[model samples]
Target: MTTQPSPSDPAAVALELERIRRTIEVGFTRTDGALALLVQRHDQTDEALKGHDRRIDDHDARLDTLERGETERQKRDIARLDALERARWPLPSVAALVAVTGLTLSLWQLAAR
Candidate 1:
């Protein structure tokens, strides 16, 4: 429906070239806009990833603190258990003394009777 410029006409050729230049300019503009948007999105994603890294680091620190506390608690519990084991070591000696006392008392009572 449109008339195109003849290649032989200087003015028409100039006009056609101008039109092509404009079209190329528009394409470049659109590409620039898209590239700008991509760069912005990449920056935002970078910030988000940095934030996640900070959170992960914080979680790791907290877990390490909890582990250290638990390790200290386990050590204390082990020491207490060991001390209790040592305390029970004299039980057999006390039991033997009670048995000997009971036997001596029974023998003395029989002699008196």
Candidate 2:
């Protein structure tokens, strides 16, 4: 058998229904606001990441330029050193002969004494 609700129960049921409706409305509004904030945050994060990537690319280009300059300078320095060494190559042999002559003269004088 189907039971019909009493008139006194109708008022209580209406009040409960109104409360449920208000709760649902508040929940949907809060969720919508949260979703909007999340979308804004994601857009900002994407822009910041793009900026960081661009800066990194610029830094890499600068580093490559500096390395090329350094390599050129090192090559020039090595060439200059090589030229200096070539210019001085004969001095050591001349100095060695002079030392030997001096030693022979000293030994001859000692033997005569």
Candidate 3:
């Protein structure tokens, strides 16, 4: 009868030990590769974030310039309106008064004649 090798056999123990060693080595190698991939992805994410920050800063600066320009334009418009307001009624009022005085003088002269 053929006998199967038991776990207590020295040859069987050595073979099992070699298999376990090979499995652990392969696991370590895969773990190193995974860590390298993780580091690379982290670096890529960091670069993208920095790029976004730069774009946001540029947009903010542009917006500030636009706001300043709009404020200046609004101030100019207000000054123009103030000038118009100052002139609104005076010229027409003076012309109307002169016309009425001339008409009154003509009427008085005709009545006297």
Candidate 4:
């Protein structure tokens, strides 16, 4: 930009305008190149993030499967424990036998009296 020019210097003003135009063209080229690099980097980042998301989803599914398997195993273990407990105590049969023995003792004591 020519700030001031003699009235008789149209050619100089034109030349200054041309120089400014060329400078602006160069700046635009640099800006375009920088923008293109940024776009390329952004695309690469997006692809990487998408891959990570897929991996995370797969991991989550695997975890869910493992949890389900663990739950089933726990249920089977609880069933086994319950069977063991029943075998150990057999509460109903034991209670009935105890009551009958106590009755027999009481009857014997009455008879003796």
Candidate 5:
């Protein structure tokens, strides 16, 4: 619904061209600012990721130490069980000896009477 500029109007065409150039310059300036901000955010994210990696590495070291301690505890427990197993037969041998001694005493008393 708007009237077109007359082909003969050089001044109007030149003014329109100047306005478009200014608009494009503004858009380029804004785009540059946005890109700069993006770069800063990316750098910040990289630093945070590095910090996380360090924490993970520290956790791994702690876990390794914990695992070694648990292994030593388990080995000690197994050794104790083995020693207990080896000592199991002496109790029955001592009981047999007591019973035999009592029987011998009874027999001797009967003979003496």
Candidate 6:
């Protein structure tokens, strides 16, 4: 027949078990702190991405406005050019006018002389 352990040995075993429980609690606390830090970093990253998206949308709106302005300017330039072409006047034919004026001037000079 075997003898049972004494009460003093059981007390020692209880102390050892308490120490192990404390160690596990400290490790879990450290892990909780690290997880909290990671969550904070993720939140900051999300905010930064939102800011970037807003800036991109602003740029897109500005680009659309610029395109509309360019189209309007081109239309005005084309209309002005067309008006200028339509308003142009043709000059008289040079050779026939010169010959007629020369003959009239020579006859007038002979009559004067």
Best by TM-score: 1
Clashing residue pairs in all predictions, respectively, total 0, 0, 0, 0, 0, 0
Lowest-sum lDDT 10-residue window in model 2: 2-11
Stretches of candidate 2 exceeding 4 Å from the true structure:
1-12, 70-113
Which residue pairs in model 6 clash with each other? none
Screening candidate 3 with a backbone cut-off below 3 angstroms (N, C-alpha, C), the clashing residue pairs are none
Q: Model 5, range 2-104, lDDT digits (tens) per residue? A: 9888868998899889999999999999999999999999999999999999999999998987777666777888799999998787888889999999999
Error of 3 at 33 (Å): 0.8
Distance from true location, Cα of 73 in model 6, Å: 8.7
Model 4: lDDT equals: 0.91
Between prediction 1 and prediction 5, the one with superior TM-score is: 1
How far does residue 10 in candidate 5 sit from its true spot (Å)?
2.7
Point out where model 1 deviates above 4 Å. Answer: 1-4, 70-113
Cα lDDT, all candidates = 0.92, 0.89, 0.92, 0.91, 0.92, 0.87
Taking all chains together, each candidate's TM-score versus the true structure is 0.63, 0.51, 0.58, 0.58, 0.57, 0.55
Candidate 6 Cα misplacement greater than 4 A, ranges: 1-8, 70-113
Tens digit of lDDT per residue, candidate 1, span 1-113?
A: 98876779999988888999999999999999999999999999999999999999999998997777666777898799999998776878989999999999999999999
Candidate 4, residues 1-112, lDDT tens digits: the string is: 6567675798987887899999999999999999999999999999999999999999999898777766677788879998998779778899999999999999999999
Flag regions of model 4 displaced more than 4 Å: 1-10, 70-103, 106-113
* TM-score (C-alpha, index-matched) for candidate 1: 0.63
